[model samples]
Target: MVAGLVLGDAWLWVAVEWSPPAYAPFYARGGFDALTATLLVAALVKAALLWLILRAPAPGPLDRRAKALRRLLYLAVAYNLVLWYAFALLPDAVDAAFQLALWTGIDVLYLLVIRWRSRMLRAAAGAMLAVELAGMVNELLDELDLRELGSGGVVGLGLTLGGVAATVITVVGQRRDGRWSRGTQAAGWLSAIVCALAIPLDILFGRISSGSLAFPVMIDAVGLVITVWHAATARELPAEGRPAELPPARQRVIRVAVAAAAVLPIIALIQPEQTPHLTYTGWSMDCYDRPSFGDLKPEERDAAFLCRARSTEGGVPPVFPDSLSDQQILAYGRALCRTEDRDERKTILTRAGSARPAWGVDPWDLVYVCPEIIGATYPELLRSTKETEAANAAYIAEKNARCRDPWPRTKGVVQASANYFLFVDGDTGYLVHDPGDEAADEVAEQATDKVYDDSALIGVAGSAVLIGHFEDVVDLCLTVKAFRTPPPQRTAGWDEVNEVPIVSRSGRLTVPEMGEGGDVGAGAPMPNLAIAGKGRYRLRVHVRVDDAGEEQHLVVVYPGASRKRLRLKP
Candidate 1:
């Protein structure tokens, strides 16, 4: 009984933990509370039933009437066991309803024919045997994947199979000797064998934790020991004598005790939990205990999810391939995002010194796909200030010698002005049309068309002369760039140094319109005199209109990083 109590409590704990979300309503309504209460009641009831069996004098060899009575006893016990298993293991409400109805209906039939004991026993035995066989077959079909057997079916199958074995063994023992003592020995052996087999199979199946099975197994084993003890002490009677019944007072006491046991479980079922959330019988603790992410505190759950997002394998562009595992990607991504290296920032810039798609991909993509590359391309990012600057020199040289050219470079832009904008990539000049002005649109079209007409300008492969709204088109250029010339200098006003605003967010150079009277000195040459070859320069200079209706030079020279010392003009 002590062993039974411990096992039962453990099983109840596990069942509550593994209970599914769908069973939340039931839990709120005290379904699990009822199950726990009933398991205790069942232990008590079974002990009393066994004591009654043991105390009765052994009946003489069975006449048809005695055989029928023994069969009825087996069926009644089997029916109860099957229902108990159903309630314990099945998560679905429908399955529980079916099993409950079956159990109650059988009991009702048994009561109807109670006066005609032989007929009632025969009828009940047939019904229970048929039920057990059907359940066994269903389980077999489901295990083979030929049918969909749910949680209820699984528990019902195990219980019925074990009950059938016990019943058959008892019947055989009774046939050999009419003594009820022999039947107790049969029960003991059957219980031992069934429970031993059941534990291993439950583990192999991987439904719930194997440890949880120990409770049910131990309880059955305890019952088996009790049966064996009773069998050893029982005495057989004369052939003509009937089995002895309990005294009236003892019978009345047993009846009252049984009633109390039944009532307790029913009351437990009706009583609702005070504070209920959705937690119920459907949750599986074993799932949370898996190797990669087990035993996580509530706070650690978000970290686990972050790890998953960075671990995507092949996609439309293969965001992050399976070449990297989730843990590796997550660790590297976090490292790069926290990096503080200036050179690491430049590694994201295009050969033209424009930062757009970082290293041929987005910054987010870098963190996910090739974090090691970010570290490799900019080693200073991961090092402390005291580390030698040349520490990565050899590694960089070795890698550059063998690494394939990271090609298909792309560039993007940001613009400050709402009017016109212009960008020159290689020999191709992109013009942004001010959609609100018909004259500006014509000028943009003419400028774009001139790119193809001029022979000196070497057109970059697949570079089309683009013309669209300043904000909608040229403002956000994510397309691949042909690495040729450095991107044009950008500024807010006249005074500045070489500033690297994130190129994706920095404005394209603003192109102001020419005055009504066009003439020499009408356009100003931006004074960053460094030119690429003899290609015809597609200038997009800002021109200031004077009162005379003539556009004059609006020269602006924003400063940049240079090694040479400059002579200051006084």
Candidate 2:
């Protein structure tokens, strides 16, 4: 009882720090308000009784056999510690091996210990009983996570009953023989083994595993059974023969240590935000206003050039022209002739230039109109005729003329290369992209207008947040692409681009740009996107085809970055 009181105090501390605050007041004041004061008073009364019992206890040294048994108990404690450490460090198979060894070692130790001082078995059994009771309570609290509560409950009950039976048998044998009997001893050892097995069973089947109640359940069952049996059969020993009490200094130290251990968890529970912080880079672009092709701050213009140069050299070419000045690039788009071989390239550049009074079309608008022409195209350099180069020159001249100063300078600076472009049509619901297929032109065009009217339905462009830094952007891109393919199909050869979860709410999560069959189903709350470190990221909409029925395209947009989507299956 004294050990339990001390252990309870320690547990109370852990509960305060780790458990939900909804139960805080229950622990603080013993229950809801003064009406529950009786509980606290009862506990205090019990503590007083136990203290009195201890004061009245004084017994002489045990026989040689009893001394040997006590030494075995110490050995059992050492074995348990070693087993715990081994379990922590080894793999499952090794851990299991060590666990079995520990269990057998402990059983042998207990058998030896009981031969000399059978009364100690009762104390051990009582402890086990307390543990079992605690386990039951924990299981109830975490029932939602358990797979088969009925089976788990049956096993728990059986183990508890077995411990009780073992305790009873041990007491009966001790009374009949003036010492512990082999049958009682066998039952006790078997019960201990059953309790050990129960730990793994609970872990595999229970809902929650932390601060587990399994150990408590086993200990309490054994403890109560043995204590009851001994009390009924054994007489009290003479005071002179009782075990010696700890010195005042040692007792004080233990009490203080226990009290501190109990209080720390309460402090931790009050403040949990200190655990850790995570951040990521984000990016975004706006194309609603006219494209001020050359209108950039000196520094920004220089940075754009650097970005373009770096892009071309680093494998992925810049989406826009890097060789020409921003002004020249914009002007060149306006100068292109419709009949030239490079007419397609000229048209793309012209549309990307400053916005016109009628330029309500978004960047996606241009992509939709010229899907095949928008993405990277090889400028055919057949040396024999220089045919492609001559044609491109003519097209560039015509593009420069038509793209000239389409939007006024008063509207604010136009971004040359934001890395992302958005296109929205007020009525057509059409959308297009730089890297989209020519075969999907009609679908892209229809999606453009839908972008504005039903942005919420469109997954790719939903409340976009930019994650800054190229590496993170690439990773986000890859994660997003992963959602498009099934687990079995995903491999090194699979598409590198994948969709990632961008929005999460109550019971639903959504990702951008998944194929038609990839729906984010409603369920318990989904996991958030965890960008492990500091950086920036931009969330935006993009276009994707409907695999089920290409004719019925949908737009999906989310409110914020909190939306959840299907996890990367692989």
Candidate 3:
């Protein structure tokens, strides 16, 4: 009877876990319809097998064992189906924990039903009972309040030791118990073996991971086979004056109960895995309402990109609190794009540009406004920004260090265009460069001995601020990008540029962090005066360094330069 019950449960677990239909409302909603149908069909097959087992002959009216077996079979069937259904409805992590608990519950019940038999079986059952109860308790405790008995912990270690001990004792006891049938002795030993194997398998596969189903079901199947073999061939024991059958009326009640147990689970199988009327809340709804993420929808892809951008902060990518839907995420991206304070422009462009052709969203869709600056979908653009910023940062660091030390002068000619030129030494500092063009009509000058003082430079459309540092007469120059006209006003054909002198000086300029796109310091890659463009023009800056006893003064030489061209296009 115990064997049949364990076998039935084993069958229940295999049927439900192998390829059972998914319940509704999973990440892929209704994705398990076919599998759900498969589970229903499997249930029908198991029900038929149970009927066959019931027809097998029994000796000496073993009513107690028979009753226990039927109840176990009913519980197994109901719980397996309920667990799968619940797993589909719950989050994956939550469902996994619940299934593990259910597995433990079923195992405990099995031990309780069969523990009264042999001394060896009782010992094995007691050990298992302790393990299961302890596991449950540990799971309920908080990590800070009390350490959980994880697979590697003391409680799990103890269970493993206990399982081994039980297996050894069972085998030794069976060898000594000469009067018991070999089959019965073997049965006790085999059950102990299953108990011993359970600890390692649980540890290896994890308590609720998918593969965990393999060992427990295997143990139950082995138990079932042994039970069937014992029932088929073993000699009958003394009747002990127990009635061969229950009283006639009581017999009828037993029959009814058995039939109901067999039939109820089969009926329960017909419940729909998910209902159309089901309502979800919080993250569940988020997943449910998400539009399909397929290559056909460019807007949806952009939305996904936007969602990733907005969700990420301070270099961390956004986590899926719950999987967001296509439409919902796209709506979020669209709303963000409309905001003026939005600083994800480079991030959007780079991510879009790097996307492969297989991805439906066109990079052009995100950066059509500034084609030249943004670079239309070139993957190289992604690394170019970083390389440029790194170069700038190294240049600033080196020049500042040089001014502090007044190091030996090293000169190298660096190329400069009308817009930007910086003397960059991988070893030294970075400086913005512009040689004096004789055509300029006005010149402004400043002299400062203290650090962090400003030098003003006049341009056609606007003026720029330059901060200088003096270390015992040596000078350092820093240019701050001045944006007098907003981005909207500065477009193609608009001639405006701020020129700084080409000289060896140590000065630092702060640019926005890369991909952050926010205001300076909010993120990297913020616009600097050096990055701005204008028509061909030049300005000459001369610096005279003189030493005081303990301090230094830097006098700026603003030689007249030209605004020969009205505009330069970038």
Point to the candidate with the largest TM-score. 3
Per-prediction TM-score: 0.24, 0.22, 0.29
- Which residue segments of model 3 deviate by more than 4 Å? 1-57, 63-124, 136-570
Q: Please tell me which model should have the higher lDDT, number 2 or number 3.
A: 3
After superposing candidate 2 on the true structure, give the runs of residues whose Cα lies further than 4 Å from its correct spot.
1-72, 79-91, 104-240, 272-570
lDDT of 1 by residue, 1-570 (tens): 455346554444333322344544443343344345544545555555456444554544644544444454444444343444555676545454454455344334333422323554555555555555455455455545565444665676565564555345334433344433333444445444544455554554333222223244224423433333323223332243223454788767556544543343334323233322111112323323221222344455334433333322232232223334345434444544555565564453323233232533334334333335655665444343234334434433343243221122223221111122223222233332222333444545555665465332211111112322212221111111111333444333322122111110121223333233321110222111212222222322222223444222211222233223221111
Model 3 vs. true fold: TM: 0.29
Write model 2 residue lDDT over 1-570, tens digit each, in one string. 234235554343232222334444454544333212222333343233223222321234566644444444334333332344545565555544443454344334334434334566555644554444444433443443445334565666665664555444444434434443232233334444444544554554322211233223223223222222222122122222222455787456435433432342233222123221111001102221222223344344333332332233334333443334434433333333122345455455555442221222222222222223432232231111345445644543453233222112312111111012112211222221212233333433444434444324332332232222111111111112111112222223221222333322122222233223222211111122222211112233232222432111111222233434332212
After best superposition, candidate 3 residue 325: deviation in angstroms? Answer: 16
Per-residue lDDT tens digits for candidate 3, residues 1-570, read 233225443333345434332312232232333334344443443343333233333345545544454444444444443445655766655654554565455445444433244766666656755665565455545323466666457766775565456445434433443323443344445445545655665564432222222233223333332232233122222123222443676445434433433344334323233322112222232323322232224434444353443333344434222234434434434533443342453344334332222222333333322224334335333333556467556654564443331211321111111111122321111222221223111211121111123222222221222323222222233222232222222222212232333221112222223233221121112222322333322332223234432222121222223433222222
Give RMSD (Å) of candidate 1 vs. truth. 22.2
Question: How many clashes does the backbone of model 2 have?
Answer: 116
lDDT against the true structure, per candidate, is: 0.36, 0.32, 0.35
